[model samples]
Target: MSSAPIAAAPAHILELARRVLEIEAEAVRALADRLGDDFIAAVGLVLASRGRVIVSGVGKSGHIGRKFAATLASTGTPAYFVHAAEAAHGDLGMITADDVLIALSYSGSGEELLKIVPLIKRQGARLIAITGNPDSPLAREADVHLDGAIREEACPLNLAPTASTTAALALSDALAVALLDARGFGADDFARSHPGGALGRRLLTHVSDVMRSGPAVPRVAETALLADALMEMTRAGMGMTAIIGDGDGDRIIGIYTDGDLRRSLASGCNFSTARVADVMSRGPKTIHPEALAVEAAEMMERLRISQLLVADREGRLVGALNHHDLMLAKVI
Candidate 1:
């Protein structure tokens, strides 16, 4: 370690940080307002292409390009990042005639990127350039140029690529989201790509995946004694039991819960003699077994209930779930 005392940040450090955020935010807002037919032309090019999108850049712009590629891939667009320097060294073979190249260079001129642009064009690949200067060589060469210019950098010295990179990243995200919408990419599509993520589980996990099924489901006939229903609830460990029609494996008509038991006790109802139907909440909220588990969780939250009965299209009880079940499944 260097034997130098660490300088403390000035008292105006908070103000400087706020100013940086303000500048970046304003830069992004300006870019958003500046967008026009050029952005559309760029989107059109990508949508028309038969191959993947290749994002290329160097330095801080490279970082933005990588993130843009990832966002595009995750949102249904097939895209990936290739370092501009690497592309010049045999990596250029990755680009094909059908591919669309998205080049990021705030200054509109990076030696490494410029070196490969001609080869990319010669290979018949279309280029979409994002730059600060509309008159730059890269912008002039691009089939479509997106002006990502900003008033100034957020850096105190105004030399760093703070606001510029932020604007590029935001612009890239805007393009990715537009592509996502244009392709009619839905939550299920997103979940398919991100199956291990929490949003994936929320979108893909069905009631059947987390619900108690078959003999595990607590069920009692409408005519069954309250004691029998309590036994079923205890056996299933779900804190509630489905009140079904008289026959075995009948359609659910109501549900009896621990809350009902408390109400029954308060009302001086005879648990020994009372029938399940008498204490059950009739026409209880039920979800289809194919319904997403997150839907059930939301329903429970909105209704201030803990448990739900999962049923088939014919309204026959097929399964059951509780807040605990959703939690265990990581669907909540």
Candidate 2:
């Protein structure tokens, strides 16, 4: 007997996936259209509250709820996820009367969550529910109900939660961004929340905080020979030296770099005889010591110079910063 041929997956599978995406997109669009006074009221309530936002849910909704909580917390609003199952098992203590509870349940009938509704109510925590069914227990009991109903699941079997979860995730993002805008959250606030990341370093780190200062600075008098300035640059290991005059007490006159040395030597200039003021590139690009390291990096790139002189407000040589400093600080 010939073996039965293995069945290939139907082409309808791709169509089903597209349909799921379309349905979920519609759900999110509906949410955007429905965002009238109720959404504003919800945001106002959460903003005026002195306590944190307690996001709770069960099953697939619970996973999305955790992400929402994390996004909210990172964007300036203090928030955390609480498993409804655990909340009924004494985790309810984490919620205070001043907190706002955002509960998620696609069917609006998660048993674990339903079991804790009364407890949350008794704690005086206001409830905001996202549900597919308006009449479901969770929705009926909430102070404000957000409809997350979808036409259908992406799953062919129609059993797995797919489109509903995507809609909920999108709504969560919208809520977090709205709150972030409402709070006037800026890059510095975000940097404070993410101190270990590159963006955080770029926003929070100042040039004064990382630039070499005091004795570490490579500097020479304007009257010094090019050879002497090169020696200072080498000894200091900064690849460049600032040439300053006596006026205004350390007024920068020029800057000498290793590149300048090569060009001078190639041109047959007498390095030993050429004064730093004569051989050096005059009016070198300088940055305020108080400027951001990232700004300093931009200056270096734009000027095509690897080293920059850090100066005071009055143009006095204060310190030095080079590409290496930016590399060490990870600003590059």
Candidate 3:
């Protein structure tokens, strides 16, 4: 008997997937186009909220909901994820009257979520629902219904929630960026929200915050001998020392460093007999203590100096910073 030939998927299946993608892309674009007073009102509601945003969903929607909460929290907004299944088991306590609760369900009828809707309402927390079926029970009960409805799924079986989830994720990102913009949130503000990250160190760390201050600052008077300045440089481990003069101390007369010492010794200058003024490099580069650490890095790169003397607004020596300091603070 001849073996039955293996069946091949019809071209229609592939075509369906492509059509789903195109249709969902249009859905997202339409959502963007519909941005108007309602979008602004939603942002205002979130901004005025005194408590965190509580995101809850069931099944695949639950996974996407967690990511949405994380994205909002990592940006400027305070948000957290609550499992819909857990809501009935006292997880409802997580919701507060001052908070905004966002419920996500593609079908708008997750049994687990429906079990808690009345309780969430009783707690007086405002509810926002994202669902494909605007007339679904959840949407009917929501204070605002965001249309996450998609025409179809990318899955050939048409059973998986594919296009709908993608649309919801994109919408969540749009809301985050819109809120960030509305608050005039700057890079510095973002850095504050993420101090442990590299972007935070680059943006939020100021020269003064990481610089060596007080006794850690390498300093020597101009009248001090070259040997004493060299000792200060070595003891401080900054490879350099600032030379301060008398009076209001507005002037930086000279800077003595390991390189200067080497150059002086090679030029046959007597280290013991030489004064710091006679051997030090005149008018070395300096930076304000309030300058951003990134700006200080740029200055160091331009001037080819590993060490920088941080001065106050009056140009008086306040502290010192080095490339190693930047590296330690992770600003480099």
Candidate 4:
């Protein structure tokens, strides 16, 4: 049976979505031009804070406050959200005298927030306000005020908190990133904070984690014929073989790759007669087994090589890896 044809959405619906995006985008852009000393002071306060940061607000601002606190906490700063309404009902006890309070209000006059501002100040905590109306009571009472004003909401009725919420969220993210930079927070630090994600796995996974060790490592002695080395590489399916020195199978003297084979054939060298020591490239690039897989990828790219012999601190070959190994680990 044929399914009934679905009705097409009205063109006005798509137009409205575009208009909303345009207004929200403009609001976020305007925030860049408005930033100055107060924004810097807010960052400084958080950086110098001896205790955690307390973010609070009411209604839509309260929702934005929760996200703001989460972003700060995730990006090297310690912060948490405290709902303005809940603060009046004894949740305020969660706030400490050594903490910094960041209050959010579009009008700078949220009754619930205003009710607790003086009380919070009495506790010896510094107050930072994010509001649209600089002249409002919240801004007037705050130690520092960061402007979150926008021209208008994207809502046609000018009532919904569309553009305002977007502006507040953007400003909060900017603050978090600025603090992240000031604290020298790096990808490794971020990965540590998110150990369950793919990025974390890529950053934390070591060369040893994905390397082929023991019999799987394609290795041949330096005195071995090129044909024997080629056979070892073929058996291992690594496309390359390590030429080890006489002392032990661990000392990597050189390496032979398919590229080297092509070049040797072009030079009219007979693989069947040549020793691996004569054809292998000396001083092959290597990496430590303890090193991150991403670092191995970097070495491969910079040296224009496809494989690396994993070595110990003494330069003894412990394992082997190639671009394919990195690809399998999703580190490429």
lDDT of each: 0.93, 0.88, 0.85, 0.92
Clash counts for the predictions, in order:
0, 0, 0, 0
Give the per-residue lDDT digits (tens) of candidate 3, residues 1-96. 769986668887677668888867876776776566655666777888999899999988999999999988878889999999998898898889
| Deviating ranges (above 4 Å) for candidate 1 | 1-10
List, residue by residue over 144-262, the lDDT tens digit for candidate 1.
Answer: 99999999999999999999999999999999999999999998899999999998999989888899888999998899999999999999999999999987457889999999999
lDDT of 4 at 191: 84
TM-score of each: 0.89, 0.89, 0.79, 0.84
Model 3 earns a TM-score of 0.79
- Cα lDDT of candidate 4 equals 0.92
How does candidate 2 fare on TM-score? 0.89
Question: Candidate 2 on 1-332: residue-level lDDT in tens?
Answer: 86998665687767767887777777678777767766777788789889999999988999999999999999999999999999988899999999999999999998998999999899898999988898999999999888778777766777898888998998888888999999999998999999889998897788897799888998889888888888898889988888889454988888888898888889999877888888888898888977888999999999888988888888888888889989999989
Candidate with better TM-score, 2 vs 4: 2
Residue 46 miss distance in model 3 (angstroms): 2.4
Off by over 4 Å in 4: 1-11, 196-203, 225-227, 261-274
Q: Which of the two, 1 or 4, has more lDDT?
A: 1
Error of 2 at 291 (Å): 2.1
Candidate 3 structure lDDT? 0.85
Off by over 4 Å in 3: 1-38, 48-50, 214-216, 227-235, 246-252, 258-273, 288-291, 313-316
lDDT of 4 by residue, 205-294 (tens): 999999999999999888899999989989999889998897774798899999998998899998889998998899988999999999
For each of the candidates, the C-alpha root-mean-square deviation to the true structure, in angstroms, is 2.5, 3.4, 5.1, 4.2
* Residue pairs with clashing backbones, model 2: none
